[model samples]
Target chain A: MDPVTLLTIVVLAVFVGFEVVSKVTSTLHTPLMSGANAIHGIILIGAIIVAGQASDVWILAVALLAVVLATANLVGGFVVTDRMLHMFRARKPPADTNTDAGTGTGTGTGTKGGAQ
Target chain B: MSLLPAEWTALLYLAVAVCFILALKGLSSPKTARRGNLVGSAGALVAVITVFLSVKLDNIPAILIAIIVGAGIAAPIARRVQMTQMPQLVALFNGVGGGAAALVAVLELGHTDDPWVRVAVVFTMLVGAVSFSGSAVTVAKLQELITTRPLLFPGMRWVMSATLVAAIVACGFIVATGSAGWAIALLVLGLAAGLLLVLPVGGADVPIVISLLNAFTGLAVAASGIVLGNVLLVVAGTLVGASGTILTRAMASAMGRGVSGILFGAFRGGSTAGSTTQSDRPVRSTGPEDVAVLLGYAQRVVIVPGYGLAVAQGQHTVAELATALEERGIQVDFAIHPVAGRMPGHMNVLLAEANVPYESLKEMAEVNPEFKNTDVALVVGANDVVNPAAKTSPGSPIYGMPILEVGDAGQVVFLKRSMRPGFAGIENELLFDPKTTLLFGDAKDSLTKVLGAVKAL
Candidate 1:
């Protein structure tokens, strides 16, 4: 974990991030933003590590709270992004007539995978 | 119980990082976007499992319960939130991620004696706190828990400046002395700065602020990676931070707003004068039957929809109206201003929700010129987007943003609740144009009536 190594990784990651999303259509902006938001939920790893290693009760309590927050951010971020994309994928000879209610109640990332 | 050695855990984390890159790439196009999301989710699943297997430590039961509690809170809400409220939900999710990152950094504070690591810790805590607070304010604004208008107070600029200066000073003290007290002070100041940063930004500009804060959270997460010596943390965080920054810029330009103008506009007060005052200027008033006659005769029509359409739950009726018009062999198209509905592309989601076909919902640039050839521009619950003042008035808040030129159409029909202004709080000059006719009512009722009238014709 040299500072120089971290700096190199940050710079390269920045380029990749900018290059990946450089040409998205406006229709995908909200979904894309939500997806990117979800990806950072990987900070859950850092949270897990911190929570698992704490020796003090106060530190453990704070770290465990971080875990809960991170878990929610990660899970919720993916589910909502998935739900939004399900609607965006509607471009055919119409799918379900009640796709709105279907997705509204069934709101599933799994809905996309299993239904298809 | 460690399944993977340190190097193997590192390698798996690296693979997970590449999945994120692919996820963002997949989202760039409509066809691959959902699949891209699935891939990213799979990566997340794998990462979580790997962490459980590769790290052995205390409080395992507590950790599981915490995770379950978190998911229980988030999943139902994300699943159930209406598409119109998508931007705020994203803001809310982004805020929790930032708050979590700040907490992680806080616990790492005294463990690091290295000044550079301490610097990263300070950076993470401050940025994370600011992003968390700023996003909360944006959510409240969008949810209308608070007034949507810019809440400016006396000496607000000075308070913000002083807080920022104090935070910077606290960060330096934490770096020099490695003191927990200075770190806590920096965190509090960061929260204040975030609140101050977003509070003055008026409603029309909250989406951009959310994007900016999303980027802030990403950077904070990246710095937390530095604090913990985790390469995956560094890469994933920087990716979100950098991409979110660029995306914010693109959205601002699409909105015809400079980033600086959005962030600091309240300090330069005169630029944000929005009037809630009703204009009594006479506009031609008509009923659903006359509108049907106008639509009943038109060969070509363009529909301009705004946030009000979503507010009135009129998407289904509006789509029905479009379908009804198309049945008569009229050329009908929906001209979506880029920032239409609240966020960019937001109208597309709403229209898609109502089963409006994708091919007919046209972007502003693609549909602007077509308005000239249009026989009618049926504006439904939309005001400022079609307002000619964007092009004509240099002094207006939304002045330079490109607008759908519905004014070029032969006849304009407005379905509105009242003669009130739009979200930007500016009066629409186009409403008073002689070619325009106002049908006053709730958008759903109005569209339903208009739909029936068009059917009978």
Candidate 2:
């Protein structure tokens, strides 16, 4: 493809893609944007791959550095996001009381913390 | 090898710009945000594919591998993250964008002998690194893996100032010398500066921090795009940066703080030492049966859930109780405060998970008026948002923070373990009110018992 034609196709795609994205409502935003943002990190990988393949020694060195930095961003971003998600995970406290149940029970005044 | 015409390329660029505009517009309303995302992504796809079409790379496999690897990691993580931690997740994602831009700039600098590219590259690296680290610290503070309170040292402001100055000086040297050594030093200093900048911010300030960092990422990405001469990058980054800034300012104002206060860590005084009336006056508590009796006889019951409800994982029990009450022909509604729980829409997500009907969940604005008609306002582990101090006490840390008007309800039943103050550390005056009855225990157990008692009655 000619440079002009290829560039034109890319630009057209951007325009249509932008329009479609704008249609997403506030309700869909949190989930959609989150997914979108994660995908956006692909740029790092792209830059790295592009850099890794450069013919010149200088380009190759630059690409290698890009790979390291971008990888840090990707890894760090994933780790933090995962941790944050854990915070929101619904965890139900087990219905245990101040008593043993292994031998069918022991001492208990009831789980004292059970809101009166 | 190129076969495309110039006019087509120009048209495609215009189309991409349109997609960007549409995506932004759709983001304005929740109903359209999904479609907007699709539109924006399509534009990105077009841009990427067009790049492929124009320039045939020798190693297509490497490019494909990069794409696959990136997606494989990000997709699962995003899928696994829950809704409640979205704010921090957002911060982390923004950080990645900034970091990526910085990395790209650094690589370009390493490869290029041109002074202009080198200068732009340095700027991108500084901005991106700072944005990334700053966002990371904000996420840490918000997640409470690190303390939400400011990590202040004596003369902390001066220290932060000095670090920033050093970073700027280092950046200057890197640009002047065009050496990787200076660049490496500058990166470390910049990272430190970012941490110092965000460390003093408390958890309450995280929303603003997230927004600001988002803006920083956008701007950094945009600068990198300019350096790389990528039009799509420039357009996308600019839109995100601008929108992020606007959102940040709006959120800061909502918390009654300014941008400067947010930046300088001056607003940490929100947690200032204030006298708390620690009432040892024993709470007149009731059992599940007694509480159930009142609720069963009541015509209207409003369920108020807070962070405690979340901590105890009592939403299902709460919903069951609501169902039981409804079965007995008693009216039950969930009253959700805007800033309830840790994040926006936290209550909604919890309730939804428990299969509570969406119609039964009412926002503060919609439910406050009904409190007067409510027979019993059951507060489950909620504190700051329901505290009457928001309206009654000027000196209270939560003063001016909007609260639920559950006080107007005929009787208030508090399901609490103890009188520990909430995130704001201010005692709930509602606890001591004559009309309020404290039901002290585990929220889930209390709720389950209440349901049982109501069913029995």
Candidate 3:
């Protein structure tokens, strides 16, 4: 809870985020954006804390609104990301022949393609 | 009873953070991306459940009702939204997150007397309000509920700057005096500034603006976390802030513009004159039957799809045409521009839904060379990516951006609804090229006719 510890965690998290996200391909960019959007839904935790500890009626109302909006963002973000990623199959099964046509090329090919 | 000790709760949050990182790592490849998403969702569940177990609440029914109502609204929309509308959906969800962060900050302001806490509360409220309104405007633009062009006028930049200055001063006053009235004023001004910031941005810039606003919301959440003294919120929010910033920069560079230029460039009125000369040039037009014949006997065909293809929901028809061509021994591949659709990778998702093979979806670099050997290049509702202006015209807005070399193919066929300019509002010189022929119609209808003609042959 100390300022130094929070700052350290914040700095370390930023580096980790950059390292992981820089590797994502352009094809998965939308899902990456959506998934990250969901992660920030951690603010729902803050919302819960505020609502639970509300001392006044107006504060309670505001915190309740926060809780509702945060929950919506959290649930919607993850679900939509799941839907998008579900469409990205490495190999389409023959039974779904109309949709499945090819294998996913590796990251190396993506880099080569991106270089142009 | 408390389900876990504070130490155990912290440990659980740490585990959830690790899951989020792994989730992103998994997203680096198509093979692992879906599982990555599941991992992230699991982390979210753990975090939420851990909070539920730890918090002792008053007004439980109210909380329950809010959760139910929120879920009810969000779930069905997420489940039923078409792929073409995904960007707008993301923007809408992002707006709610920002609004929630701002409200949390508002609640915090009433509870905290500490100066640092007050500052954090004000910071969160300002950033969150801006992001909320900015993202709402972005959604409106993408949904076609508002004009997608830049709504700019003389002195607009000065007006936006003045609003930002006023909001900051209001925030400073609230932090110093703990005045509720000033806090409310700051929130309203912040929201107004957000709207003004996005209003002058044209449609082509919305994706970057959305990404940037996503980063703003993350920072706002982090500020709220500090107000509440929660490490997990701080870490997750910071991670999002970092990733969103990187993505925003990458998207801007992909379009050959800097972030500052994109934010301030006011593009609508300045570029109209540059496009006039090319509009007067004559273009050769062709019918669907001729396009079908031209495509039927081709040894190789490259399909270039753009936002218009997504708008018309023509991915399935294009895929059907490709399959029909393949059945006749013609080789077919798709060339995707990096910034092709409204969002990055937009075209790929649409095509993947239609069952196009991932390997057959080629990037600009990979497919550009192939066009030289291509017997025919079919452009489906795409213009800016194939425009020669990106490479040749220094005065054009898209001059330095990389484009698909569909012009290099032996023959070029464009399926268009009209000669309207693309999102960039620049004339495509390739349309006037002697090697190219325009077949005007709805993309889905034209592709279907081409499919029928090919089948008849």
Candidate 4:
């Protein structure tokens, strides 16, 4: 394919992706972005391959730049994701018992004939 | 050499853009985000297929292998993560996208020896490195692997400012001499600065910080795309960058925080300390059976759930109790405060997931008046929101925040673990109310006992 056509198609695809992303509210933002990020990683790999085979110095330069940026994104994303998972794993503090009722204190209200 | 008509190509791009718009629209509601994602993905797939068809591939297997491997790892991780952790997961993923864009920029520059390309490579490298490092710090903070407290050092601000200055000088040096070493050093400085910049931010400001980083990533990616002349990259990056910035601003405002306050960790005041004064008044206590007796015969019972419900996984049990109450021919309703949990609409989602009937749930405005007529108002694992402090104390951190007027009910039964303060670290004044009876235990355990008592009645 001609460079112009390739560029055109790529641009269109990205626009579509953006339109989809823009529609997502807070509820869907995270998941949609996550899915898109994976796609970006795919793009990164492509850029890397393209860099490896480039006959022109400019192409090689661009490819290397893409690879660096993409790698950072991939690694950083995983780190943050792993960190968030920790929030769910916190050990709930044991229940404080000093405030427990039904003890000898008559201040405690009870149903008639309620056991201590 | 053109393979496709320009008009058709433009049309296809327009279609892709429409998909993005639709996907975003659908994403506004949780119920539709999944479908929105599918539609957005389909657009991406179309783009990928177009690219595949346009390019002459000598080795298609390599592309297939990469896709399979990447999807295999990501799909499982995505499936395993719970909804609560979704934000952190998003932060991680967004960081990766930023990093990827930076890498792409670097590769694009490496392919060219042109001075302009060299300059673009430097910019992309610095931005990408910083974005990656900043995102990592954010993730660490969110995960609690790193301290949520401000990791501030004396003169930390000056040190960061100096590093940023040095980076700028290094960028100039790289541009002047076209030296790759200088560029690399500049990137390193930016990365270090990114980490330092984010590390000092407290946990309270993390959501904003994450969003800001997301915006930065988007901008960096867009810059890289512009440098490489990838229209797709530019368009996608711009959209992300713009949207992320808007979101960051909105989130900051929603939390009543400013960007500066979030950035410098500057505004830690009375709010952080929580409510002022420990109430000296003693709390009224109640037995499970007595509470159950009151509940069993109550003409109307209102169950108000808070963060405690999420911590104890008590939604299912709460649902069961509601069912039991309804079985006894009592009017039961679950009153949900908008900001009842850590996030908005948190209580609603938890209850919905537990299969509680939507008809039983009532918003604060809808049910606040009902408390007057309610025979028993059962507050489950809730504190600050239902606290009388919001009403009585002008000095309280939660003073101005709107709360459920559970105290107004004829009889208030609070199912709490203890008299301990909430996340804001404030003692709930509602505890001291003569009308309020404390049911101290695990909310689930307390509710179960109450249920038992009710059944026994």
Candidate 5:
């Protein structure tokens, strides 16, 4: 808990962060931003601790507000990031009449026939 | 005072910090990104649980209620938000984090009497409040609730500098006297400074501004950590601060502008001056049928997409058109600029949603050379990235930035709504080149018409 030790940890973490993130390709930048946004949502812990210790009514209200905002930021960030990442799926199988005939689905036949 | 022994808590904090780092490492590659996100969330879970275990509480019910309410609001927005709105969503989430950090710092002021703790509290409050307000403005701009253009006025720089000086002076006063009143004043001034900082920046620079604000929030969290003596917060916060800073710099350089220039230079209105003269040049126009015929016969084609593509919701149609072209034995590839969409990788996400193959998507450096061999370069709703002005016109705002060499192709087909310039408000000379033909209409409508025309041929 020494100030010097915390400063040392901060400095070293900066180096590690820069090294890891510099390698990120441009295509993944949105997820990278979103993930980091969620990471900083760690501030939620500070909110919880502060709200729990509040004695005055006004201070308690402010602390509760903080807790709500932090929670929203934390949960919202990660879920949105997951949603975005889900969209980056690999290419779907090509539409082939032979494959569609084997499956025998009416919807599948309609789509393939429409494409042609 | 602690539920767990001090050493045990410290060990857990170390584990949490490791998770955070490994999470970022996983994000560096597409293959491991989801797992990385999971790892980071797990670390957050651990950190929150640890806080509950360690802190002695008077209002557990209130805290739980707040958490539930917050999650109730955030979860739905995250779930239902369209992909095009992701940048604004991120900005809004970022604003909440900053507001939370600032509020936490304000609450800590009464609990701590140590001079160092008081100083850290003041630092946290200032940066956190600024980021909160600044990010709000960014959200409004991105959401189109306000004009996305720079809102500059005469003497704006002087007003901003004076406000910054006042905020710093107030912070020093709070640290020196430990007065609550000075601390409140500093927060207000800081919020004003944040607004002033972001208001004059144009829309093209919003991604960089968001990154910078994200870093500000990180530092604010770190300062809060210092006040609370939590090493995990300090480490995690610093890591985010560093990462955000690096990203902001990379994005700025990618656009060939410095951070200071982006913040202040555009305000002089020099970038938009020459646009009128450039627009006077005659441009060649082509219809969708002609475009389809030209594309139908080309052996190889490249598509360059920009923010306009997202605006038109044309990703799915464009992908379908590419497939149609490919069916006719024409090779089709996509060239993505680093800053292509509203955010980085914005186009990729949109295209991927339409099931465009990842292998067919190429970066600027990799795809620029291929343009020379391309029989037809199809630019869909993208102007700035393919603007030859970036390489040739010294007076252009986008000059000196790397661009797609679509002009080198045998034929260039541009799909635009009109002769309007791009986001940077600069005319694209590439549109006027003899090799280039403008196919004007809504991108999706135009692509659909072209698809039908190609089918007929």
Candidate 6:
């Protein structure tokens, strides 16, 4: 890629990154950080590329190790984040997937037995 | 060389990059956050598929095996890890990512002869190594494998400075001579620098260190992208780096510290100043019955939770108590400080895990004004967050950091393990106030007894 193209992507990404997360409430900060952490696990692509093009057995060994580590980072990051978010679930989901912003409606609605 | 045309490959990669942006955007709102994560994962899957489809590769079986092994080890742990240990787990995952990026950059060293690319490779390797080792130290500190207090030494600053200078010289050597030996030297220096950087940070500031290292890894991955000429890598990496930096800044301010101050405070002994002294002053200590009476009689109650609540596994008990209070027609709200848990906002996750309603868990800014009208304020296993010293005492370490203002309530009740101060080790003046009553016991035991007492009332 040319320097100008790469620089443009970088600049735009920095702004987008800042803009997207700048407004997150403090309650969601941990999950947001964890989610971003998992997103970077996409570095598995770089590991795969290195492993595929390894010139010899020694280089292949290191590249494969990279693959394993990157996969864990990516997979575990997402899984853990989802688990955290699951706790912030809708108080009442009757197989209802959309149109329910459980965050605001969660107050004053749960029975003693319902929430637990 | 790739089997697909360059244009097609670039277009596919662009789609993957777009998925990442959408993923982050969805995370801003609670409702869309989970879907956003799924989209991000879909993008990752597409990126992997694109790499395999566009590029003919050898060792297919080995790569698949590696991925399977990594997932097999990670999934079970991620699914079952206790919420209390989530911070350490995050640091560990981040450390491994940094390690992977560093290793990828190392392999790229042999394939590139361009001096600038070499510089990118060096940057990736150096920053990745630092993030990797720095995150590991943070994990150990959080897990109590080592003392959580800041570790300072004679001439440590000089040693840290020397390592940086040496790493720079090694970078020059690698860029100039293209030698693997210089790369090896650089990696060692990077690892040492990581250790030195995290060792002097106290427990209260470990989350900030983790966030900072997370940003470091993002930048490292970006540098790796530059070396591979992969625009997807560049975009994703930069996004994480930027967001992580902002999060770190937000957490520091929430704790009333600056990024540089937390990182370098040990040089002036600020980070090491966690005072463990038990104040000899008399405090009016009571039992769960009195706490129960206080809660039972109050028309409005606010619960201030801290890391200690999680440490004693009292989240469920506390939640039940809140439910019990609400059943009596009392307005119940949980006042959550931003840095209330091992990580910022972590307490909310812990409470949510206990099935507490999200709306009832109010952030500091939203609930601070409500304390005055609150008839009772419950401090459960939390000290520093509710400590009035944050606003009243100028010389206190936590001064200027916002607190839950439990002092404004009609009566304050604390479920404490002892006179031991909070993570910052600052004595809470509110504990000694006439309006406050301390229940001295483990948070879980105390909350359980209080729950029984409240039900009786």
Per-residue CA lDDT of model 6 for B262-315, tens digit only, reads 888888764356568999999999888989999998999999999999999888
Error of 3 at B37 (Å): 0.9
| DockQ scores of the candidates | 0.50, 0.10, 0.41, 0.12, 0.51, 0.60
True contacts kept of each: 0.80, 0.12, 0.76, 0.21, 0.80, 0.70
Q: Give TM-scores for every candidate, taking all chains together and pairing residue i with residue i.
A: 0.95, 0.76, 0.93, 0.71, 0.93, 0.95
- Residue-by-residue lDDT tens digits, candidate 3, B318-398: 888888899999999999887788888888888877767677888877888888999999999998888889889877767
> What ranges in model 2 sit over 4 Å off?
A1-116, B1-24, B27-31, B38-47, B56-60, B110-120, B174-177, B263-270, B274-281, B327-331, B357-360, B389-397
Q: Which candidate number has the best DockQ?
A: 6
Candidate 4 wrong stretches, greater than 4 Å: A1-116, B1-13, B29-32, B55-64, B112-130, B174-178, B267-307, B323-349, B356-414, B418-436, B451-457
User: How far off is each candidate at the interface, as Cα RMSD in Å?
Assistant: 3.2, 8.1, 4.4, 9.1, 2.8, 1.9
Write model 6 residue lDDT over A7-84, tens digit each, in one string: 888999999889987977777888988888987888889999999999799999999999999999999998999888
Per-chain TM-score of chain B, candidate 5? Answer: 0.95
Ranked by TM-score from best down, the candidates are 6, 1, 5, 3, 2, 4
Candidate order by decreasing lDDT: 6, 1, 3, 5, 2, 4
The residue ranges of model 5 lying beyond 4 angstroms of the native Cα positions read A91-116, B267-269, B272-281
**lDDT score, residue A49, model 4?**
49
Where model 6 places Cα greater than 4 Å from the true spot, the runs are A90-116, B392-395
Instruction: Looking at model 5 chain B, report the run of 10 residues with the lowest lDDT sum.
Output: B271-280
Model 3: lDDT of residue B211? 90
Give the alpha carbon lDDT tens digit for every residue of B1-457 in model 4.
Answer: 3456556655665565455455455545544444554565566556555555444443345444544454555556555755455556666666666666655654454456566656666776677677778878878876778766567667787888899899888877766676767766876897888888788766545656766777677666656655655544555555556666666665565454567766764334434445345565688988898899888999899999987877787776787788789999999999987556544444655665455644567777788888899999999988867877666776654555567878778899999897777655578767887888888899888877887778777
Alpha-carbon lDDT, every model: 0.87, 0.65, 0.84, 0.62, 0.84, 0.88
lDDT of 1 at A38: 95
Q: Scoring model 6 with DockQ, what do you get? A: 0.60
